[model samples]
Target: MLTLSLILLPIIAGLITLAVKGETAKTVAVVSAFAELALGAYLYSSFVPDATSQFSVSYDWIHSAGIKFSVGVDGISLILVFLTTLMVPFIILSTFGNNYKNASTLFALILFMQAALVGVFTAKDAFLFYFFFEAALIPVYFIAAIWGGENRIKVTFKFFVYTIFGSLFMLLALVYLYLLTPGTHTADISALYQAARVLDVETQSYLFGAFFIAFAIKMPLFPFHTWQPDTYEEAPTAGTMLLSGIMLKMGVYGLIRFVLPIVPLGVDKWGFVAIILSVTGIVYGSIIAIQQKDMKRLIAYSSFAHVGLMSAGIFSRNIDGIQGALIQMLAHGINVVGLFFIVEIIQQRTQSRELSRLGGITQSTPNLTVYFIILMLGSVALPLTNGFVGEFLLLKGVYEYNVWIGAVAGLTIILGAVYMLRMVQKSMFGVTSGITEGFADLTFNEKIVLFPLSFLVIALGVAPNIFLKVTEPAVSQLLSIIK
Candidate 1:
């Protein structure tokens, strides 16, 4: 029931939002988002810190095809569930300062996307996971295409094409696995794992490629990352938050859930290739971010870089590596969303995302400056900030895997500090520019949005164990399975 409510609340509220008008829709969305958060809190309270799935519920969906509507929570899924529920209200609230056209539909789509994200995280059936996986794209695609900037149509089309193209590979992989199941041919998560385990190393390697392609494109890991910056730049801030903060996690989640244990031999064979690509992306994205004059686009590349480390850590396939990836997912989601909102606030006030055109915001908006610096420090992995523990563990894991790659991967920290602080120096300091001379501080509503995020940055940093304890058992279990 807890799992069901987590998925259903957003869905039901989305339907309600569609029928409401004007401010009512926003009200409904905010209420719904908070309600989801409450459920997430209860879920955390109820969930035991162990590897076993809890609150599981399954119903026959396609009886003839052997698919069931199965959903549950474990430590790994719970953290992400928490992230989705925790972030949605803030994402919605962040938009309060603007008056978008057809506001009802926009909020409705956010709620719907939330529902799909929850579904993806909790799903325990292979086909059900795939169903929710693809279902999530619809609302976000509409969110970006309809409400985004001047080039939204072109940029979103490429995004749509890249994701849909990648998803086909995932579907193909799932379908192939389904046929390999014994007896009744179920697509249960465990059954898929069992079937996959019997395959030859060569076959598993092929499966690895199929699954990796789908997830890589979603994480938009290096070579596959072309669509990301443009889409982030063109999408509405809410849409960008959803994409960067929550939606992209689906890919990382898929890598951990579907790829690792199910295809261990495959991973052993081809995982190094993934590690190389991910490390390359780390350096590649950070360098590109340093060159970006547009704040949103810069953060987009930053996100791309951060996810590369997460991917590399997971592929490292050690306890530290995978555990680090899990905690980092939560930290990255929080920090990135806050960063994008900071960008949104600046853009909203100054009508520009260009670093060259903005300056001296700190003179007027001390509160905004403080929050921005906190989130920025978190992004650069300052000690005792949210980003620190995860990156440390990730680098440790990568080092255990290979010294040279770990050395290269560590560049993200230095490069991140350079670009992010540069952004701060150029945008927040210096003499007030003509455009930013009268820039105002955070509005009451904007404060409401950023305050929690700012608090979380320090809190997660100070006591990451609150989160790490829950995921450790699950990570151990996964490592055992893969081994």
Candidate 2:
């Protein structure tokens, strides 16, 4: 019942928002998002970490085809679910000052995306997971295309084509896996996992290739990442947040759910290649980010870098690696959204994101500078901040897998600090430029969005156990299956 409501509320609210008039749409969306967050918190409180799945509900949807309307959450699912619910209200709140054209429709699309994200995280069946997986792209497509920058049409097209291309492979792989189910064909994920365990090595390799491509494109790891920065630059801030904060996690989560357990042999065989690509992305993205003059695009490349590390952690296939991935997912989502919102704030006030056209912002806006520094520190993985715990654990995990790769990957901290602090120096600390002379402090709504995120960066860094405990059992279960 809880899972059903969590999935339905955003969808229901989105519909109602479409019919709403004037400012009521934003209010309705915000209120509904808050309600969903409360429900998620309650679910977390009641969740038994040792349990396999909680709030599970399934119904016969296609009797002959063996596909069921199945959805549930375990410890692993809960963390991603928590990230979804946790980020949404703030995503909505961040936009309160901007009067986007057809604002109701924009909010509605965002909420719709939310519902699909929750569904993706909670789905317990392969087809159901894929359904939500593809379903999520639709509203985001509309959001980016309809409400985005001028080149939005072009960027959105690329994003759609690239993602849909990967999704087709996912659908194909799901069908292949489903047919191999014992007795009557079924799409139950657990059953699929059991069946996948016994699959021949060659078949597992094929499945691995299929699953990895889909997730890789979503994670946009390395060479597959071309679509990301352009999409982030062209789309509206809210849309970018959706993409970075929760949408990308779908791919990382899929790796945990599908590729790791179901195709362990294939993972063992091809995992090194995946790690190489991920590490390459981390380096590639960080280098590109350093050269970016556009604030938003810089953050976009930074996201590519951060996600690359998370992917590398997944392939490391050690307890520390997996747990670090889990912790980092939450941390990354919060920090990236904060960075994007800061970009939005700068653009809104100065009417420019050009690093060269911006300067000495800290001289006027103490509040914004403080928040920016905090988020920046978190991104660079400073000690006693949220980013530190995850990056440390992730580095330790990668080190366990192969010291040379870990050594290469650990360069993220140095490179991250270089680009981020340099960005701050040019944008916030130097002499005021003509464009930034009118810079103002964050608005009430902006503070509402940023302060809480800043708080989480510290709280989670200081005591990661709150998030780590929930994922331990699920990670344990996954390792058992992989073994």
Candidate 3:
């Protein structure tokens, strides 16, 4: 019932929001989002920090097709569920500063997207997971395409085509796994895992390729990442938050949930190639970010770099690697959303996002500067901050996998500091530019959004155990399956 409510509440709220008009719709959306967050908090509190799936509910959906509506949360799912619920309100609140043309419709789509995201995180059936997986894209599509920048149509078209193309392969892979199940075939995840493990090495390798393509594109990793920077730049900030904060995790989670355990042999065979690509992306994204003058595009490339590390950590396939990925997913979502919000604030006040055109914002907007620096430090993985714990563990895991790759990947920290601090120096610290001469400080509404995110950046850093302890058991159980 708890699991089901988390999925249904946002959907119900979205419908109600659609019926309402004007400012009321956004108010309704925010209240409903908080309600959903409260429910998520309860679910987390009641949850046992162990390997078992909790709050499970299953019912027949398509018996002939061997599919059922199955949903639940283990520790792994809970962490993501926590991230989704925790971020939505801030994502919504961050938008309170701007008024869109069709405000009601925009808020409604965000709520709908949240529902699908919860569904994606909690699904216990393989087909259900894929269903939510693709379903999550629709509202965000409309959000980006409808309310985004002038080039939105062209950019979003490519974004839509790329993700849909990759998802087809995942659907094919899931269908193949479904047919291979034993008598009374089912798409139940546990059953699929059992069935997939028995396939010949070559067959599993093919499945691995199919699944990896789908997730990699969603993660928009390296070569597949061409769509991301443009999409993030063109999309509205809220849409960008959905893409960076919660949506990309769908891919990383897919790699952990579907790719790792189901096709261990294939991973053993081709995993090295995946690691190489991920590491390459880390360097490539950071370098590109360093050269970006546009604030949004710079952060877009920074996100690409951060996710590349998360992908590499997952492929490392150690407890430390996977755990780092898990915790880092949460940390990255918070930090990136904060960073994008800062960009939005700057653009809103100074009417500019280019670092060269802006300066000395900190001289006036001291509060904004502080929040930006905190989130920035977290991104660069400064010690005793959230990013540090995850990056340290990720480095440890990658090192265990191979010292050379780990050594190359370590450049993320140095490069991240370079690009991030440089961004701060140029945008917030130096002499006031003509455009930023009288930049305003953070609004009360803006503080409501940044303060909590800033708190999490430090909170998670100091005591990551709050998350690590919960995920450790489920991660151990997953590694056992792969072994």
Candidate 4:
């Protein structure tokens, strides 16, 4: 019931929001998100640390094919669930003073997105996971097309088509896996894992590649990443935030949950190819980012770079690599959201995000500059920042696997700092430009959005142990399976 409520609350709130008007609608959305957050917190507080299945709920849905309406959390899912719940309310609050033309519909979409994402993480059955996975894309597509910047329609179409094409292949792969299930047959992920163990290496390789292609496109890694920059630049700030911050993690999460453990031999066989692609993406993204004048596009490329490192870590096939990738997923999500918010705030105030056209922001808006600098540092992986811990662990994990791979990937740290610092120098320092001279500091509402994120950036950096502790057991169990 608790699991069901987590999935249902947002949907109910979305319907209620449509009937509401003006401030009342925003209030209703806020209250709904807050209540959902409260429930997520309760789940976290009551979670049994050593339990294999915590807060689980399962029911028979289709017995003939052996599918069940199953949901549960171990530590890994719990942390991500908490992140999703916590961030949604903050995202709602962040929109407080904005003129979101159709407030009710916009808020409703957000709530719907919330419900779908929760379903994605909580689902234990493969068919249920696929259902939620595809379902989550609908509201986001609407959000981008309806409220986004110029060129939204084309960008949204490309984004939708690119991901859907990849996912369709994954769905086909799932069906293939289902057909191979033994005895009573099941789509439960655990049952699938057991079945995968006995499958021949050739079959596992095909299934792994099918799933990998889907997740890679979703992560928008390198060669498959052509659609991302336009989509990020054209989408509304909030939609971009949700996409970069949360949606991308679905790919990383899928890799950890479904790919690595279930097809260890396949991963072992092709992991090097993944590592090479990730390294190439890191370099490719950074080089492109340095040349971009558009702030949104720059950040979009930077996002590609960050997630590239995460992919490398996932392919490292070691405990540290997997654990680091998980931590990086959360850290990257929070940091990207904060970075995009800053972009939005700047655009809102200055009417532009072109680095060449803006100057001397620090002289006019010191407070906003301070926050921006911190976020930049986080992006560059400054020591004692959340970015540092994840990168360090990821690199260390890579080194443990292969010294040459680690050496090549390590260039990202320097390259990341170079582009990020260059962006800061160009955008924030120097004589005030006409556009920046009249710039205003962060409004109260903006501060409400940034403060908590910044705090987490530092807090998690200084004491990542809190999050690491939550993920360790699950990661260990996963690693044990691969071994």
Candidate 5:
């Protein structure tokens, strides 16, 4: 099936890359990633945009236990799959500027991570979903721990431990629901959904806690987010891309797929509490970002705030909220990768990311300055940029949920602009600092990554319905399920 090819091609290519030597592996990986992206685009074109799952592939994997190796894409899964396939080639190509040691192994890990991520997005069986969910952590763990900074070992470990702990709860929740299935027990997601929906409000509340803690930790919301800034600051740029750009989406996607439908009663009971955490995180992360000096760490905090808004929108439980969250997920992924890529180029060229040391880059590298400004505008949700449409709808969704909560959450718009504009002023304007005096303009490889991203920021903003249309039916289906 086309869906299977979408998930498996990178896996085979990654295995092939492991045997390659030198930069050849990186080349192979990049080409294969581009191929994967093309396949994903084809899948998107072919997808019907209906509520029903399409291009399904299923078979018995463990007959006695009623386990199955099943996967498919509905409109719900389609957009996330498109995001995964679309972002990865760029993620791979962005690394062409660096020649990491053991390049084969490094690139292979990325491809492996890609394969696992596709699996997470596509898996239709409960245990199958959990398998891919946890599988993604392994390659990223090595990517961070082995290739990261002086504190990489400890920080990556903490990140690994935190995520794994959360997943244990998900594993328990899935198995509990699996056992609850009527007749012969099974791990099919549809069956699990039905079984879960019929539970009493009290029981669903407990189940919600289990799934919510896991997804909340993955989204790394608020108090559960201590490990993120450190890990992002220390990991390789490519690894940071993986975490912020894609892996975090696993949590948001899980909330839409598993938590909301299976535990609607629980959502009705405690969705307000979830909204509180998300909104608090939005305000809390924005305020903290205002104080950070390191560019990557600041962006890390900014990423937290942006994700908080998306999370708030998702928990808002309206058509606008869910659709906005979906659209914002794609926009945020693109903008964050561009932001981090800019930071990586700066650090690579000047060996520093501190604002005090970074002024006036525009004096010498006006082109890069332009690129950074566009990406920053995208991050701040400037009108006609990709961020604007999503943020607008998200705010509308939350406001509809409760005017007071939406008003609190709306502070993100103002604070986001303040800190982001501060970053632009301190880093790009005025006289060139000593470190930036000899700054080179954007490289060909750098252009390879930023140009397309810049174009996407504008194009998607002008016509967001290209994404929204495919997702509307599915989101409507989800809303009906929640009822």
Candidate 6:
């Protein structure tokens, strides 16, 4: 029941919010998010580290077709659930002062998004996972289409079409796997995992490719990443944060939890090709980010760069690489949320996100600049910041797998710093632009949003062991399965 609440609370809240009016709706949304967060923390506190699948709740949903409404978490899913619950409240609070006309609708959509994402992480059956996986897209599409900037229709459609096309392949792969199950079998992920492992090598490779393509497109790696920049640039800031900070990690998580484990031999066979593409994305994304003039687009490209490294780390097929990828996923989620929120603050004050048109924000908004710098440092992987720990671990993991691959991919650190610092230098320092000369410092509410994020960035950097300890045992279990 507790496990079910983790998925149901937001959904229930969303329905209630849909009926509320004005500021009351926002209040309802925040309260619901807080309640959800409290529940997540409780779950985290009680979680048994060594338990194979903790806090599970299962019920027969479509037993005729061998599907069940099963949901549970191991260490990996638990941490992600906590992250999602923790962040959604902030996402809601961040909207506290905005003047979107359809505040209730927006809050409702965010809550809906929260529900679907929780479902994605908790789902134990492959069919249930696919249902939630596709369901997560609808709220985000509404967010972009309804609350986005001009040109949103085109961007959201492109985003929709690109991801859905890839997802079709995944659906096909799932159906194929379902067919392979022994008589009167199930879509329980564990069952599928066992079934997938016994399949012939050729079959495994084909299925792996299908799953990989779906996840990769969601991760928006390299050539498939074209939809991201426009989508990020045009979507509302809260929407962008949700997409970059939390949603993108879903793809990486899928790769770790679904693609790699179920198709270990396939991954071992085609892992190098994946690594090459990831490294290329890292280099390509960074170079393009350096040339971007729109701050949102720059961050979008940076997202691609970070996820590239994450994907590469996962494909390295070592404990360090996979563990680092997990850490990086959490760190990236928090840091990117902060970064995009900073972009939001800038846009709110200056009515623009253009780098060339904005400058010298520090002259009037020193406090905002300070927070921006910290987030920038986090994005650049500065030491003693959350970003540093994950990137360091990822590189170390990759180096252990292959020194050359590590060296090539590690250039993202330097390039990331170059572009991020340049963004800070150009926008926060130097002469005050006409547009930004009168900019205001962060409001009290904005401070509420940013301070915790900044503190976490540094705290996690200094004490990543806190998270690593929780995740390591489960990651080890995964690696043991593959071995």
- TM-scores of the models, in the given order? 0.99, 0.99, 0.99, 0.97, 0.99, 0.98
Misplaced by over 4 Å in model 6 are: none
Candidate 2, superposed: residue stretches over 4 Å from native: none
RMSD of each: 0.7, 0.8, 0.6, 1.4, 0.8, 1.0
- Candidate 1 lDDT tens digits, 236-298: 999999999999999999999999989999999999999999999999999999999999999
The better candidate by lDDT, 1 or 5, is 1
Clashing pairs in 2: none
lDDT of each: 0.94, 0.92, 0.95, 0.87, 0.92, 0.89
Clashing pairs in 3: none
How many times do residue backbones clash in model 2?
A: 0
* Model 6: how far residue 271 lies from native, Å: 0.9
TM-score-superior candidate, 2 or 6: 2
Worst lDDT 10-window in candidate 1: 344-353
Clashes, model 6 = 0
How far in Å is the alpha carbon of 284 misplaced in model 1?
Answer: 0.4
Q: What are the per-residue Cα lDDT tens digits for candidate 2 across 155-199?
A: 999999999999888888888888888898889999888878678
Candidate 3 residue lDDT tens string, 301-365: 99999999999999999999999999999999999999999999999988889999998888988
Any idea what lDDT model 5 has? 0.92
Looking at candidate 6, what is the lDDT of residue 324? 81
